[model samples]
Target: MNGIEHYRRAEELMEQATATRTNKSGFEVCYVTNEEQERLTRLANVHALLALSAAQADATEFKRELYRANGEELPAAQSAKERAEAKTARNAALAAAFID
Candidate 1:
């Protein structure tokens, strides 16, 4: 597969890992080896790139919405990484059914 395709796949992996991190363990990330953490970080980066490329981002409030959707500020070091993981998760859930 090409680079963008790889990015899409990485985004999927990040989404899955985020779900497991949030739902099953109720932790952002914990108890993973260094290799696993590195992989997860890479996945988050790919998802952020995909999200930005696909996004219209038409409003000023979109920035705040991203944070709210993410559910927290996330750790300082992990902030960007976390936001990207959440970009397409919760807010998209809201946007899909939002009434105009």
Candidate 2:
């Protein structure tokens, strides 16, 4: 699936996790258990990350293509090790942002 598809799936999961229903008495109620909700939220986050990664890759590819079309020498790409470290740091920051 593409980035937009993954993003849409993530949004759908998030909605399911937090959705409220009107009970017969006309009060809003959540049917999902805490554990289930947490699981759904985690899944949503995974999809969101996948979408973000795909988007970044697409952007990089587009930039490379544009440079090529302009007869410009492409900039050196990051080494695999550098990319891994950057991804690790980015993930750490994202995790930290979710901490209480």
Best by TM-score: 2
- Identify the candidate with maximal lDDT: 2
Task: Supply every candidate's count of residue pairs whose N, Cα or C atoms clash at under 3 angstroms.
Answer: 0, 0
Q: Predicted candidate 2: what Cα RMSD to the true structure?
A: 12.8
Candidate 1 residue-pair clash tally: 0
Q: How do the residues 54-82 of candidate 2 rate in per-residue lDDT, one tens digit apiece?
A: 99999999999999999998877899999
Compute each candidate's TM-score over C-alphas: 0.29, 0.71
RMSD of 1: 19.6
For residues 1-100, write the lDDT of model 1, one tens digit per residue. 4445656777776655554355475756545666776788787787666656545343435766777798966334557778787886888788877954
Off by over 4 Å in 1: 1-29, 56-100
Least accurate 10 contiguous residues by lDDT in model 1? 52-61
